[model samples]
Target: MAFLDIDALVGLFPGQGGYRKGALASFWDEGDPVLRGVLAEIDEVALRVLGTDIGSQIFGPAAAIPEGPELFQLAVYTVSVATYELLRVREVEFGLLVGHSMGEFAALVAGGALTVAQGAEMLCHRIAATAGTSGGMLSLSCDVRRVEQILDLAAEPHVVVAVVNGRSQVVVSGPEQGLARIGAVADALGLPAVRLPAPAPFHNDLMSGVRTEVVKRLGRVRCAPTRTPVYSPILGRCYRGDDDLVDILGMHLVTPVRFDTTITRLHEAGARVFMEVGAGRTLTGLVKAAHPQVVILPALTEPAAVDTEDTDEPVDVPSPQPSTTDEEVMAQLRAIYAAALDYPEDVLTADAHLEAELGVDSVKRIQLLGRVGRHFGLEPSAVNGIADHETLGDIAGQVIASLEASGGR
Candidate 1:
């Protein structure tokens, strides 16, 4: 299958603003750009909602911001909305929908518990409200029972279970001191633990301030019935109504996420494909570790070979693999673009106008620009003016013009 404009999905991850172009190119080359496109799209949303560099702070692109106590909730909403959009587009059949941390919101959105625009607005509200607390979260690979015992023994302040990602992986959160205590405990226990690059401690008591605000926001929005099966990390049951969505979403902001259990149960129920819809392969990695027998796919990931900081890499270019012949090159380019668009190839021609003939709307044009930029090594910025190209032949002619400008083939 030809690559879809996957790089466009970077709008999903918040911390990845610094590497957008490089990230998109690498994503396209990975042969699975759907996830990339979803992530890019979500990142765009994050920038629009939080302004400035909120996404960077959340994803460790920079230092964490003090969002007061509601910071956790804000983080959750951002991640959730991204996932929601991915699931909304495919609506693929699955035995269960599982989310890690704030990803539960995505599950709810995918299962039809919430509307896309509503989810986006809610995420905005969450981030705006939670910009108060300064904290972080940590993930540990250890025996859950032992970890719980250690938590009890240490009795640290500002510490709580954030997520149970697997039998061996548990995410903990709270204040810095409490997290430090947990880390010390984990070290003594011989459990491998790493502090997550999050802005605030999520799924912990420190986020109590987020609860009232989240509830108030929930009151302002009406959830719809779910069209797909969604397993709640809080209730540990399948939910299908607005009330359930509200309850789960509200409680999830404070409750520990049981993603491990949710995934296990889903697999047991016969779910084979686990698709990480928006941003990063964090969930996919966890699922693979948790269930080695299960097949998991991440929508986006950094290709190991690509250097994210290399600006010299062709911008907005397509895959570098050359076509067999000149005619084949143009035909293949058209095929790649058609497939990238998920549009019919029969509707396209070398001289066909992208806008007039292919009906390349603005959104699609932007998406195409992302692909074309990758293919040609051209970095895509907001193009200021319409190019003079009125046909595919015109586009090809421009490519030749650019190559000639650089004294090329």
Candidate 2:
């Protein structure tokens, strides 16, 4: 099982429904004492940076935390580090380490390139350096060439394709007006588009100022050669021990994420079991889409039964629940979305436009769909038409239809 570090930011919150809150809790409950000590150290750093207990915010009752690019990035970094520690305590091993977007920092820590505290500190400085930049990103359900053609047609050169996630998914980032132009072009091209909830256009030339500052700050942090191989999609290859971590990571801010190519390379390198180490199964789904034959698992949400035979310790994770009625499914989904998006349950009615009215972005949309797929025991591809649904009611109806078709209810 070649463990793949799923980016924490892929999922909005760990404990929220549609997410495996129990799985996250079990890690802390069943982990070694050293795991707890590591978490305590991380908590102290988090308190200093955030002025609040990040552990409490994530592990406590489901609630909305401060929403912004910097804070969101920090929360992702915290959960990722904790998840990595839990995996280490569990004695899970990986042949290679890869992270999506900000997940690279967690990969570095897990691969022995940086201490948890050093990684956390670097993330804090990263947030500070990139703060107040003006721009946004949009996810287009089209290939890179199509997006580039659309941009050319619209005469919008500012918007650059920030991430090539898959054959059908590409993320573009630039000035707000440029993003708007891309949206219009996508609409005119009849391509599905969703605006990401980003405060600035990352992985694009818009972040040049951020890059310079981050590079200078990153040089001050001590980094060692990675213990495990770390594959960098931003650099389009594996990171040699002698590579300049500071320059590569700094340039990562303005370079496009070639995840599609990265996954292919991993497969070529003989990685069969891809395990996502963080909050959600976003990367899992993407990996499945790109390489369907590979075994994919979510480290934060895997059932204990699957691993009991490998370990001497007993595992006590919950089993899958019995199928529920359509109404029950709808209600559960509503609650999940509400908790995940931090919106009132009442607002997630049949008529509410998920994107327009509720401001749900592509990342959150993927999280919601991933949760819905798990809750109902559906395949990852089962939630394909999620974007076509305009309202919660529309989504509920789709889920019901899928359930009925699958004989799940």
Candidate 3:
């Protein structure tokens, strides 16, 4: 049976300053029932946490800037949850989800692992627990290996790589002195690095104390199984039904985020379309750099009015069938894999072993299968045996089998 065009939706939650100026005003003026409902929920939580209406703080005349670390983190969380609700009301469906740093709580809520109320409470507690910790984060335009090398050379005990965002982008977190040392090293190498506007050194050993407290609190809080699969880059895998949510979330505080690997895994799992669900284009930009061929849509862009009515719904885009002949299918598969892997078409052939001959890594193999799945309109289950295919010819055979199973001509 032919399935409805299934596009993988990835929800992105921004870390800081996600809601730009006038964000509240836009939500109020639009008067979307979904937005209103989300606002009310957030306001209720804000009142309990901040002892004031967050709506007024954000939308009132002479709006107060989110100054304190705790308040700023709360603002980011609240706005992200509201944005997620707005998307849900519009019938946006997510196949897989991920978040950056503080955005993980938002991802859990969106994925149904936690309710909005639970998420708000957890986030507020996290902020409160980690508030006085010293140190900060710095973004570096260098690979993880190089960053580690620099850290090793510097011998700075406090600083550590906090995130592996992409092939060339990483974030390091530590005290001011450690950061200055790292910056000097980057300068010597002529690499660009900038200090992130974070109030504390998050996703590092510095937050171990906070992680323990949060985990204990999470144990007392009830959590439901996830509806949408939420991948934790920190844990380097998707949250399974049997896994301990509290332990996972607790460890997430001290683990470095392997975002690059997360994207690869999602693509391998047949996710082709990624959408940034929250207030900025940060995650969108990272995804683009990681996978240029996949479709990316941003739910919000700064300085532009959010018009929920005009957003295009994801529909299955048709793929061309070159021919049904075995030889033709093999040729087409080679071409697609070559293009996706940035290798010349001649480098791949029916006899070439995907790994030994073509240098196809595990992540690249997953990407290859996803592309094939989309091209021939195969069901996700149809591609489940992709790991068994060792050579180009072997993959071609599986594709032919899937085509026949799907009643494709």
Cα lDDT computed for each candidate against the true fold: 0.52, 0.66, 0.69
User: lDDT by residue for model 3 over 1-409, one digit each (tens)?
Assistant: 1121347577777564344435545666667676677667767876776565566655547555455656766666777777778778778788777877778888889989888888887776676667677888877667899999999988998999988878777889999899989877776665556555577888888889989988766566678889987777777766777777677777777888877887777767666687776654556666766777878786645342231211112323335463487877777787777656555678677776554234343334444565677788776556644444768888889888878776785
lDDT-better candidate, 2 vs 3? 3
Between candidates 2 and 3, the one scoring higher on TM-score is 2
Sort by TM-score, best first: what order?
A: 2, 3, 1
- lDDT for model 2 comes to 0.66
lDDT of 2 by residue, 125-207 (tens): 77778777888888887788898898888787788888887887789999989887777766665566766667678899879
Assess every candidate by TM-score.
Answer: 0.55, 0.71, 0.69
Candidate 1: where is the Cα deviation over 4 Å?
Answer: 1-95, 242-244, 297-409
For every candidate, C-alpha RMSD to the true structure in Å: 16.9, 10.0, 18.2
Tens digits of per-residue lDDT, candidate 1, 175-265, equal 8888778777765654445555465676777777786777776565677777656656567766755464544566666777776776666
What local lDDT score does residue 309 receive in model 1, on the 0 to 100 scale?
A: 13
How many residue pairs clash in each candidate at the backbone level? 44, 2, 0
Model 1 per-residue lDDT at 307: 15
